[model samples]
Target: MSDGHPFRGNWVARMYERVRKCGYDSLTAFAEARPTASLEELADELGPDDIAAVQVFSGLVAEAERSGKVTRLVRGQLVRELAENLPDGWPAVLDDEVRFAVAEALGFWSAYTPETHKERVKQARAALRATPPPPGWRPLGPDDELLLTLLPDEEV
Candidate 1:
């Protein structure tokens, strides 16, 4: 990924391009389709950079879901694909936003233990507290909402 922006760069850009080329009109459309075979095919093509794009895309989808831009069904399906299909440590490589998103998704889907989900959410909050959001960033998205639910009232 590029240092200039969280969403730009070769792999992230290509991921979007591939989505369109794969016959999906948008990420939401792809999520709705839940084309497992196509997703697996894309996963096979992923290098390190492409994996990073998946992480970022995961975060973006989470934010959209929280904002009601994405429906619950679509969000669940997309996150499930990401969590199940990606390599191990994929969440670890991401920033707080992506980590928090993945945690929320996993918890919602019951894909991991309650304890494990709590730990992941805790780690994500700590990371958020340590690093401020980038310029032009907004607050109260999915990450903030999840953190509020996980953290003590005073902390929120």
Candidate 2:
């Protein structure tokens, strides 16, 4: 059925605009409220001329979830493996300062137990000072922010 309004393009543009003005979840819920229809159906009824935006948004959500899960799994595995490989009495063997540095380098401690990890890091650092890790280690820094800023935004 023709949308009574004279507008000719797909109405998903309006949805996208709404998302830009409000938020993605809000627009998604708003779109979903017209439950009897699929995204294409809703687009046709609302006057959106194309489904590109909907397709893009859907793809983005799927990709992000997939990527997040994969990265989480890999990082978790690495953390477990590293923790297992450390010499017995890891904290005691490494100096406090060196332990902290190692923990920071590992990057797995950002979750709920961060402070505990940091404390362990300090202990490890103290022990490690006596026998430093081979020279290539250095603190990660601010340039990474540029990479983060360059990532694309999701749109639908």
Clashes of each: 0, 26
**Alpha carbon lDDT at 65, candidate 2:** 51
Q: For model 1, how does the per-residue alpha-carbon lDDT over 2-112 read when each residue is reduced to its tens digit?
A: 454334566556666666776865655654454332233334343333445344346445545455443343323333444454423234355777666555644443432
Once superposed on the true structure, which residue ranges of model 1 sit more than 4 Å away at CA?
Answer: 1-8, 35-49, 52-67, 70-156
As a whole number from 0 to 100, the lDDT of residue 116 in candidate 1 is 21
Candidates in order have lDDT scores of: 0.43, 0.37
* Model 2 agreement with the true structure over 1-87: per-residue lDDT tens digits: 324442345444554564555444544344434432333444454344443334433432344355443222222222332333342
* Model 1 steric clash total: 0
**What is the lDDT for 131 in model 1?**
65
- Please give the TM-score that candidate 2 achieves against the real structure: 0.23
